[model samples]
Structures are given as structure tokens and as C-alpha cells.
Target: MRYDDDPWQVAIWTSTDGTAWELVPDLDSFGRAGLRDIASSDEGLMVAIGYEVLPPEEGSQDPFTQAGKIWRSENGIDWIAVEGIAGQFGDVAYRQGEWVVVGAIDGRAVIHTSADLVNWSTAMLDGLESALGESKAPCPLTGRQRRNGRSLAGWPISAPPSSAPQLAWRSASGAGMHWVGQVDWAE
Candidate 1:
């Protein structure tokens, strides 16, 4: 199991008999902007996300307004840092052949695509919103969304990391929608 409580903290749990449980923390540690979503990739490795954060204290200033960070682990229990990624507090989903992460920037969602889960490509998210046309996708460390919505405002609330078709994330909504998204490897 994973940490569904806080986006910044990651934990691995194991139960051989189905009644006992133990938590494991990985070593692939890195600074987090907000620490949002986590997913297992096709390579059988665990991936953790990081992005822009509100800073430790509200009154304090964050040198970097928002940045992205990525962490990976070979086993579910131990983690390692992936070099060079930016963004904070958003959503992470494994899709097609890459990781689709979404985060907010200046009150709007910024989207980016990554293939190796280490380096990232610029995402303006023009297909989704205009404000993001020329803006870079904000890195999200932790994001959450419901499962459904009846109106446009509810878009992010209904789409989250899904656990169907083996293991993959289907939601493509921009950062604006990442509210409470969590990793669902098993549905």
C-alpha cells in the first residue's frame, strides 16, 4: 500500500499473510515542492512525483516559485532520486510510454510529459487552456481529483489515477484538475 494521507510522504506496506502489515520507506529521497502522486512503471519500478510547493511556512518565500522533482525505486520499499525534474503539487499518471504530470501555475494548471521519469519535456498545455499556451507546466508533488463531474468546473474532480488495464493513468486534464489524485495501481 501507499500513503494516501499526505502527498509529501511515501510509504511501502507488506503483508505476507493478509492480516499483518509493515511500512517501508525508500532511499531515493529528494526535496519536494509538494509531493503529489506515485505510480509504478512498466519497468517494475516505483515512481514518486514532486513539484511546486507553498514553502515551509506561508510567510516565508520559496527561492524557486515552483520546481519539479522525481524519485524512483527498484523495490516498493527503497527509493532513489531521478536527476533533473521540476514542478510541484499536482498529479502523476503513467500513460502510453511516458509519465504525464499536471500541476498549477499562477492559478492555472501546467502539463508536462516525461519518458524516462527523470528528465521532462516542456508542456504548455495549449490543447487544454489558453493561459498555458506559452507557460510551462508547473511541477506537482501531490494532487488529487474525484472520480466524476457533471460540469466543466468538476472536470478535475472526476478524473484521477486509475488502476485498470494492468496499471495506468487515464486522466489528461490539466493541472487545474489535480485536487486529490492518488496512485491506484490495482484499481
Candidate 2:
């Protein structure tokens, strides 16, 4: 699922053979007024992130006011919003029997973990505390797990930290890279 442009609407493209693709229409009924990211679980569950904007009260200077939500689908056709998620989530990945979603809340990095995809728990990424006042936009996260029982989460770091993308990985013994900074993607 992605958006190229438009009247700012979302589109779902399906590929049956990995080589050919077709558009799946009538998704406006999904009630996902806006979608940020999506992921699926091996257990046949699909989840998407959506948002509802709330205008700031009078005399407020903040122009970006929004409420984030998570939506779930069984067959990718019908959907319903999951209760309890309170911030924008830009990425999600399922690994090692757990579903992990990362984004930001109140301009701070937040992580959500779930085992069943229905019930979720949230936590703040302590390593990202320095970005609290310096970064306002949600940093999109990409989850990576290696075959050696190592797990990594990468995201573009902002201000007070050199404004470079960093990777943090953990090992089985609970110690690993806290921040491998300034990764060059071109190389």
C-alpha cells in the first residue's frame, strides 16, 4: 500500500505473481482517511496506521495537531481501527513471535509491541530522548533482525545528534550497538 499523489487518496495494488500488479479499488470504505504505514503478520493479520487531525484551540500557534490510530484487517479487504494507540506510527514489522511498531509521540520516539496484534504495549525509546525538543516530525523506523538472534531498528536521527541516520541493534545477551551513526546508503 502506497500513495503516489493525488487528490491525496490512498490506493492498494495487488500482485498475484510478483511480476504483474493490479489496482484494488473501493478502499475509501476502509475509513483510513490517511494512512502512514502498514504491516502484516504470519498469522494472517494486517494492520495500517491512520490519523485524524484536531485543530489547535484558539490562540495556539501549533499548526500540526493530529491524533494517530491503528487499523486492523483480517483479509486486507475489511478493516477496523484498533483502540488505545495514541500517536502516529510510521512503520511496523513482525519478528520472533512479536509485532513491533515504531513512530513518535509528543515528538519523542515510541515503540509498541504486540504478540496477538490485537493488544499492544507502548514504550519510549530512551535513546531518543535527546530528540524530544529538537525533532518534531515522526522518524520513520525500519526494523531489521539478523539470523544470529540480533535485532536492529534504524531511523533518521535529528538535531542535537548530527542529523544522520543511525542503527541500534541488540544481541541475545542484551548488549549491542546503541548507535551506529552516519550510515552512507549510496555505498
Candidate 3:
């Protein structure tokens, strides 16, 4: 799982048995920010994605919403940011050795894939099933996403809404990013 902040941050956890869990941190660390989610690639990379909930632009009514950036870490510590993800991004996950992010497309969610967390390409969800909308790929990483419901695709491009899709991805059925079954913000 991950949380939010300035530059963004992520947390990983583990347990011998599902009964007790331990927080995985105090090791390789990324400076704090509003991190939205965490995922791992089979090749051993960690990815975190989110937006900066902060100060407005110096002279405008709002700061140009910073485009979402990708952060990758080897061994879940010591981080690196992937430059050039356009627009405010919502979530991310790593699968196999590929990194996939959930970002808004025309105000709706879309899937993006990156072999390395630094570069990304928005993927076409061909008959891709989402627990929520067609391309609303975000999986709310927090309890807050649990409270909201479904929304229309490509509807929020220019305006803000009370809720947005939570970013999540497919992972191993028993562990990692896939352990949660399915995560959705609007469904």
C-alpha cells in the first residue's frame, strides 16, 4: 500500500501468516509525499504514483497541476523518479517486470505500461475488464475509495469531482499487488 504527500511515498508489508503483519520501511526510503499505491515487478522493482496536494501556482488561482511522476526503487528502498508521465496521475503497480500506472484519460481512468518506471505508454484496455468503468483503472489505495461509487468514463477532463478511480493492477493471486482481489474507487 501507499499514501499521499509532496514528492510521494510508499510502504510495503509482510507476514509469516496472514494473522500478523509488519510494516516494511526504515530501509531504502523516499522523502515523504502523498503516495497513492505500491507495486512490485518480478524483476525486483518497486513503483509508487500520486499527485501533490499542495500550494497553488505563484501567480495563478491554481498551480498548474503537476503531471504525475513515477518513482522506482530496487529492494523497496532508495528511490528514483521516472520523468514525463503527463497530467496528474492517480495510481501504479508493477507486474512481472513491467510497471503499469492508472491515470485519468479525458477525466476517466486509463492504463499505462512501463518496462522501466521511467517511461510509460497508455495501454488500450481491449475488452479489458475493470471492476468499475471500462477504462477507469484506478484502485483507490485507501479506505476513502471504499466509500465512493461508480462514475462515467471520460467525463471529468476539465473539472474536479468528489471521487476518482483508484489505481490498481493484476498481480500474483496469493501475494503482492494481486493479493487484494480487485480494487476499485467507483464500483
The per-residue C-alpha lDDT of model 3 at residue 14 equals: 71
Candidates in order, TM-scores: namely 0.49, 0.70, 0.50
Q: How accurate is candidate 3 locally (lDDT)?
A: 0.49
Give lDDT tens digits, candidate 2, residues 1-187. Answer: 2222234455677797999998767676554256767778777788887664455566767653557777788877777778866777777776657777777787667667777766778766665656434556665454454544556665655544565556554333434335556655443
Question: Residue by residue across 55-149, what tens digits does model 3's lDDT show?
Answer: 44566555333445567777666777777666546555553465556555444445566675556676442322434444443432222122232
Better of 1 and 2 by lDDT: 2
- Of the two candidates 1 and 3, the one with more favorable TM-score, higher being better, is 3
TM accuracy, model 1: 0.49
Instruction: Give the top-scoring candidate (TM-score).
Output: 2
Each model's Cα RMSD: 10.3, 5.7, 10.3
The true-versus-predicted C-alpha distance at residue 79 of model 2, in Å, is: 0.8
Which residue runs does candidate 3 get wrong by more than 4 Å?
A: 1-16, 27-29, 59-67, 105-108, 123-187
Ranking by TM-score: 2, 3, 1
lDDT of each: 0.48, 0.64, 0.49
